[model samples]
Target: MDWDKLRIFHAVADAGSLTHAGDTLNLSQSAVSRQIRGLEESLNATLFHRHARGLILTEQGELLFDATRSMAQRLDAAEARIRDSKEEVFGELRVTTTTGFGSLWLAPRLNKLYEKFPDLRIDLMLEERVLDLPMREADVAIRLKEPSQADLIRKRLMGVNMRLYASKDYLDARGRPEKIEDLSHHRLICQNVNSTQVSAGSTYTQELLTYNIPSLLTVNNYFGVLQATLNGLGIGVLPDYILADFPDIERVLPPSESREIPVFLAYPEELRHSKRIAAFRDFVTEEIFEHRKNLHESGDT
Candidate 1:
């Protein structure tokens, strides 16, 4: 099996169209098609079924896709490591982060880094879904939770405190809840479509029973919760940094029972010693640690 042909096949599978994949790789459509045909011939299996819409992967293709993706990622990482050894920070820094944090915090800070090192290209991937960093999907990942994988290095950058907050108008109309039991009477905004446990053997659904609040609005994204809270829809439990500038919003409950989401900087264990990765990791750690108190206080607004 030729690795180049496999790489082209993976690209086509990922892009879902020969034309799209060809554009991505700067190859002509004919060249990409030939490569895919070569790969299929080499493997003695039909990888994709052609359709007017796009190419659909066959059962054999699906299996090969999974294995080849991992292999391709490792190969790319190895090349990156080799290039880094030459003392040039000229490679791309593929970073994955949650939409909210990437937009509100990290994006702004990255400007200074870029200004300092113009050769260091940054591909900022903003998504709610966590990317598989071990497979080389990203060079660095800013995760809300600690990485449990044994081969990854996890650094706790800071703790994000979630507080219950509501607009002054909503509180004035509905009245403030004095105890956890009183929350049952008030309207609440619930985030997380499928509630997962933050810790081992723990379930968020089970934890929700403790609050026992009747949800007025359910949103999948944290930004949705913030918008709803701002509109005086209901009280929302959100990270403090998100609400820092909103003067109308007030923290309804003290820090009791507040969930602390630990922010972690995760990367492959092997890339820890790389100068570029080390520099970025240290810079982010120092900045966040210095502003930890401010991040907590910002939510009270």
Candidate 2:
């Protein structure tokens, strides 16, 4: 019931060690232990199971921790809102997206963003896992699919297809496969079936494997597949979004592509008024517009 005690308990539960929690809270270990004991006494609950390794949450502690975590997120949202009142996009903005898109697409274009907001500190988290925007795990997300999370402002950024591509050097050296069946003679570079990718990409890879390609180079992410293909390794199944930055790679078997994968940019609805979020969202939207225009001028269908 005490907000200060709840805060201390959350820190201790998170760190799983009184000493570590003490260090974070700027309190002595004894002080932190006393707070935890007081909190437990007030609720008549055993919050943690002490062990040689660290404190493990008891059943009651788990429930309390969940409540504390929610409170922490709400407080984080409030803190972010307060920071945004300065009307400056000059603070930490945590962005999340897939490694392929982040590295090949968004990361390269970030220089323009930096040029505009020189003081902005962007923590770009690149992974396949979808971060919780509403919970403040990330400030913004560019995902391969729509985020189903509630209380989020979602925008469709772009569409991508899991299409086959090969480096010009690779195609020249090995002879490009003209048809899907011709893939049997070439090495295949793709994401492993076990990898965390959109369903469309995995489904496309699965369909390609049916060709019974003799040689294979499967990586956990598209970035690896891109590098391998760049080195003249094999035909790689990659997203079409890479084409804007990497036109040197030639599309192979253009008709053999996967269903469209929708790319979405999302943030918490609560972040609607944040200047950092506004700037970032506008930057991304402008980049998408430019990309589409270039694709059109280049006669891309």
Query: Local error of candidate 1 at 45, Å?
Result: 4.0
User: What RMSD does each model have against the real structure?
Assistant: 4.0, 1.7
What is the clash count for each candidate, in the order shown?
0, 0
Candidates in order, TM-scores: namely 0.76, 0.94
Instruction: Name the 10 consecutive residues with the lowest summed lDDT in model 1.
Output: 196-205
In candidate 2, position 63 carries an lDDT of: 99
Worst 10 contiguous positions by lDDT, candidate 2: 292-301
lDDT of 1 at 237: 65
Give Cα distance to truth, residue 94, candidate 2, Å: 1.8
Clashes of 2: 0
The numbered model that scores best in lDDT is 2
Per-residue CA lDDT of model 2 for 197-245, tens digit only, reads: 8999999999999998999999988889999989899999998877767
